[model samples]
Target: MLLHIDSSADTTADSVTRQLTEAFARTWHTAHGNSADHRHRDLSAAPVPPITPAYTTLGRRVEREGFVPPAKVPALTESAAEQREWGLTLPYITELLAADTLLLGVPMYNFAVPATLKAWIDRVTFPGALTDPDTGESLLRHTRVIAVMARGGGYGPGTPREHFDFQTPYLKAYFGSLGVPPENLHLVAAELTRVDVLPQLAGLEELAADSLARARATLTALAAA
Candidate 1:
């Protein structure tokens, strides 16, 4: 399935990342037709488990044995124990492994990605789950990813504030560490700035459009292949 994971926390109806993601998905579906299965997850609306101590412990066990440990015996008036018991559900490792493509909608927050998106990455990046334990090879066999990003300021290469843009570099390193090739990591960025900088902003938009067109073409070829 083509899993579309939107991590933008913007509740506003006119979210740029959401709009771009929807457009990308629509184009992808139109090209692939019934050959592709669609699945969507909104991390902002339904927050997944953050990486807590209990979460880490449960995740480790699941990674080793592919099963969560059984619940312990309950004690009298142990409401806290009930909460621990609920945490024993098996992690969604299998669903992640089964995905063919992952379309991520990531927005820059304080020069980085949202914590919710990082949490999702933590869940999927198990030691032996998505990587080789002995050789340190990535188990993310699927090679396609489309990351749609947006920022409030212009930060492309050669721009004065480009050094401040850590979103692309961080995401590239993170996903590259997981075996996604540099060529497979496509980004579409939109810059929001002051009205006085509209001309420069238009240039950025043109660059983004050109990149998007190239990405769509590459994806079409990949789908055909």
Candidate 2:
């Protein structure tokens, strides 16, 4: 099964990242048809709850004491609030563990991922959740990840703002920590998406169009792969 995660704050019509991801999902569904299952989680429309202090404490205690089934978390904690918080966040982890592919529709917000996406990351990233506690194995080692991102400015290699591209590196590191090797992760970016609307970027429209076209083509091929 594949999990499609959309974190774009803009409507689908306005969000380049969303367009790419949706195209990917359509292509995947067409290629895999009845053979694969697909699920979508929109972080923008229905945001994941922020990790509270109680949730953090519970997660730490669970890690120290060893992993337990989500249903068994109540046995590890007496505080109802902690249990409730665990209940809220455990589903996200569960979905990740069950997915064979993780499709992330992310857009650069202030040179980084959207805050809602970060909250989702924080909620599901507790130790023993993405990693096996007994064998120290990475649950995501075999999972494929495709991150479709959009940026308002050019940040590719040799670009003046290349160093400002925190979105890609941060995601690469985040997935790497979960045991997804470099080969299993695919990144497609549409840069300078604001060129058409901003007078200062008027001459960069062709670059933006080329970037978007390439991103679309890449997503099409990757979805089939």
Candidate 3:
């Protein structure tokens, strides 16, 4: 089963990562047909709320009223943000656990992953609630994640501004700690996204197109696998 998630806030044509994920979803359907089950989440439209301070301040009970049957003990009267935060986090983890693979469409925002995507990660992986305090074993460890990313500039190894990019490495650590293996966490990234829109990057248009083509080809292989 595949959980297809799109976090792009830009319009369809303007969002390169969304376009890449569309290719992935289309290729998967063509390859597997009805044999594979699919679920989708558009994070931009229904954004996941940010993790509240109470997420860590409180005891290991964020998933209580969020996932399990038991209700909030004292009923979070401290703050409305705290109460609402718990209500949304567990569902993210629940959806994440329902799939064998995750196809995420994310755009680089200020050199990092989109805020909407970061919010989802922070909430779903709350300490104590979603992870074992000691062993850190999580159901998410069994799932594979394929990230379709779009960046405005190049940040490959040894690039001039390579150190400026934090999205890829942050994702590796974020999902890695959750049990998504480094090998299983795949990235299909198209850099130089501003090439077609900004005059300063006009020369990189061909490179951007090549990256998109490569992303599609990689998705095809992943679908077949």
Candidate 4:
């Protein structure tokens, strides 16, 4: 199954990043049909809680000893003790483990990712959950991630603003820590601000075509493999 997480908060009908993500999903589905099952989470529309003190405490226990704290145990009263007695971040971790591919649509916010996306990262980045405690083995195995991001400014390689592109580097690091190799990380960025002066239909079409082509090629390769 594929998991799609869209973090763009823009609700405008013409949101470039969101539109591109939706288009990617639609194209992939059309190409693959029932061969793939998709599970989607819209972080901007329905935000999950940030990592809380309670969650942190529970996470620490799980990381250190692979167990949940006793105090937090009673809070999970609705389910069987064995099933509901873990840290709050366990569900998110499980979700990551359940997916074969992860498609993330994130917008650059002040040169970084939005807080909602950061929170999602925090939830899934638990030590001993995605990584090993001793040898630091990645528990996530051979999963892949495709990140589609949009920025107001052009920050491609060698650009002055490239140093400010923390979103891709951070994501690469986080996913790498969980055992996803560099080759499996596919990134596509749209520089919308560069189109402000041009404002021409041809320019927009060119950008969209390039991005869509890259996305389609990557998805097809992944599906075939």
Query: What are the lDDT figures for the candidates, one per model?
Result: 0.66, 0.88, 0.76, 0.70
Q: What is the C-alpha RMSD of each candidate to the true structure, in Å?
A: 5.5, 1.4, 3.8, 5.0
lDDT tens readout by residue for model 3, 1-225: 899989999856768888778778888888879667988889998888676667655435543434332143236425665556666665776677678889999898998988888878777665444454456466667788999888888888888989988888888888787677788899878888788778877777888788778877887798767
lDDT of 4 at 123: 67
Off by over 4 Å in 1: 58-91, 132-136, 193-225
The most accurate candidate by lDDT is 2
Instruction: Flag the better candidate by TM-score, 2 or 3.
Output: 2
Worst 10 residues of 2 by lDDT: 65-74
TM-score of each: 0.72, 0.95, 0.83, 0.77
lDDT of 3 at 14: 69
Error of 3 at 196 (Å): 1.4
What digit string (tens of lDDT, one per residue) describes model 1 on residues 1-225? 777888888857566678777777777788778667888889899776755565555445545554222222121113553345233322445556667778888888999999989877775564355654556565564557778877766686798898998888898888887788777777667666222356656546656556546545544454444
Tens-place lDDT per residue, model 4, 91-186, is: 777788788788888898988889999988876775466654456566566777888888766676786777989888888887776678888787
Candidate 2 matches the true fold with a TM-score of 0.95
Q: Kindly report which residue stretches of model 3 are placed more than 4 angstroms away from their true locations once superposed.
A: 59-84, 132-136
Cand. 4 TM to true fold: 0.77
- Flag the better candidate by TM-score, 2 or 4: 2
